[model samples]
Target: MRVLGVDPGLTRCGVGVVEGVAGRPLTMVGVGVVRTPADAELGHRLVEIERGIERWLDEYRPERLAVERVFSQHNVRTVMGTAQASAVAMLCAARRGIPVALHTPSEVKAAVTGSGRADKAQVGAMVTRLLRLDAPPKPADAADALALAICHIWRAPAQNRLQQAVAAHRTLKGRTA
Candidate 1:
């Protein structure tokens, strides 16, 4: 499966495309950061983000989109920008009928580095190793985006099975009721 991972930020949103399934070698299809001027109006920034995400979706045509889940931070403004950027990513994918998954920062770290507390350096190093790239992706955001894709690629199979089981159980219970 090809997955596009998005590390959303107002100023520098990371976008990456990876292809592979669980237990198979993965390939990096594309990776880049989307930059918007901090001084840009919020509405204009969001539009720029939307356009960037749409371009990636059109080019890579990923089957799924995995985005970093926005969590609480001390800075409300930062969090709000992140959430808005994330929303644009989700909207872009949804419009294209691609499945979207949100993975927490810790989940992505654990998936890539075997530790939830892994630092940015560790995550970047692991991502470079996993993708078999000679050098790590730059600016941290780029590597984080790749890590998010890797996390989804590894976890989606089990997640799908769990969802199916829950749906079947609900159907059975409803019929009995």
Candidate 2:
């Protein structure tokens, strides 16, 4: 499956595309950052994010979009920008009828590095090795976006099975009732 991963930020939103299934070597289709000037107005920043995300969706046409879930931070201003950028990504995917998956930062770190508390350097190192790249993707954000895609690719199979099992149980219960 081809998945696009987004690490949303106000100034530099990371974007990456990966294609492969679980238990196989994945290919990095593309990786980049969607940068907006910090000095830009709030509305303008959001619009820039939207345009960047839309262009990615149009080009990659990923089957699924994996976005980093916004979490509460001490810096309310920072968190607000992240949430806004994330919303723009979701909106772009929704408009294209692409399925969107939200993964927490910890979840992504654990999936890629075997530790939820792994540092950015460790995550980048693991991502580099996993993707067979000679060097880690530049700017921690870019590497992070690739990591998110890798995490989703590795976890999607189990998640699908769990969903199917829940549905089956519900159907069986309904029949008995």
Candidate 3:
């Protein structure tokens, strides 16, 4: 499956497209950021994000979209912009009938780095290594976006499979007892 992962921000929203399935290597299709002046009106910033998503939809037409869940930060204004930007991304995905998944920053970090407390630099380093990229994805936000997509792919059904395996192991041990 192909997925477009987005990290929404008013100043610089990161986007990444990755294609793969469970047990298969996910390859980077594209990674970039959408930008609007910090001073730009909220509506204009949302339009910018919408336009960016539309462009990606036209070019890649990913089957699924993954966006970072809106988080309330200390700055209410920042949080508001993020929510607006995220809404635009979700709307774009919905318009195309593409399924959307929203993951929290901690969840993405845990999936990528095996720790929910991982900082941006750590996640970025792991993402670069996981994708086997020569260099870190440009701009920290872009790397975070790619990591978010990879995390979703790794944790989705794969988590269930792992749980099943553990259950089976326990059952076998119980039978032998």
Candidate 4:
């Protein structure tokens, strides 16, 4: 499976593409950061984010998009920007009919580093080892994006089965009712 992972931020949105299946080697198709000037108006920044995500979707042709889920932070302003950027990513993927998954920061850290409390350095190290890269990706955001993709590749199968089971149970319950 090919996945495009997005680490959304108003200042520097990270984007990475990875291709692989379970129990197989994964390859980094591409990795980069999308930058929007902080001074830019919010609408302009959002538009920039949309264009960046759309370009990635067109170029990578990913089957799925994994985005970092926005969580509460003391800085409401920061969280709002992150949530906005994340929405832009989801919209871009939805337009192309690609499946989008939102993984929490802890979930991504655990998946890549075997610990939910893993620090940025630990996650970067694990991502480097997993992808067999000589060096960890830079700016922290890039590594984060790759980690999100790796988490989805490893978890999506079981997640899909769980979703199917829930849907089946709902259908059965409705029929009985």
C-alpha RMSD of each candidate structure in angstroms? 0.7, 1.3, 6.3, 0.7
Worst 10 residues of 1 by lDDT: 72-81
**lDDT (0 to 1) per candidate:** 0.96, 0.94, 0.88, 0.95
* Estimated TM-score for each candidate: 0.98, 0.95, 0.87, 0.98
Q: By the TM-score metric, which is better: model 2 or model 3?
A: 2
For candidate 2, the lDDT comes to 0.94
For model 2, how does the per-residue alpha-carbon lDDT over 1-177 read when each residue is reduced to its tens digit? Answer: 999999999999999999999999999999999999999899999999999999999999899999999998899999999999999999999988999998999999999999999999999999999999989998889899999999999999988999999999999999999
Which 10 consecutive residues of model 2 have the lowest summed lDDT? Answer: 94-103
The C-alpha stretches of model 1 lying farther than 4 A from their native spots are none
Candidate 2 at 59: error in angstroms?
Answer: 1.2
Report the C-alpha lDDT of model 1 over 1-177, residue by residue, as the tens digit: 999999999999999999999999899999999999999999999999999999999899999999999998899999999999999999999988999999999999999999999999999999999999999999899999999999999999989999999999999999999
Clashing pairs in 2: none
In model 4, the worst 10-residue window by lDDT is 22-31
Model 2 TM-score, all chains together? 0.95
Q: What's the residue-level lDDT of 43 in candidate 2?
A: 96
Q: Candidate 1: TM-score?
A: 0.98
Best-to-worst lDDT order: 1, 4, 2, 3
Query: Which regions in candidate 2 have their CA more than 4 angstroms from the true location?
Result: 172-177
Superposed by TM-score, candidate 3 places the C-alpha of residue 111 at a distance from the truth, in angstroms, of 0.4
Lowest summed lDDT over 10 consecutive residues: which window, candidate 3?
154-163
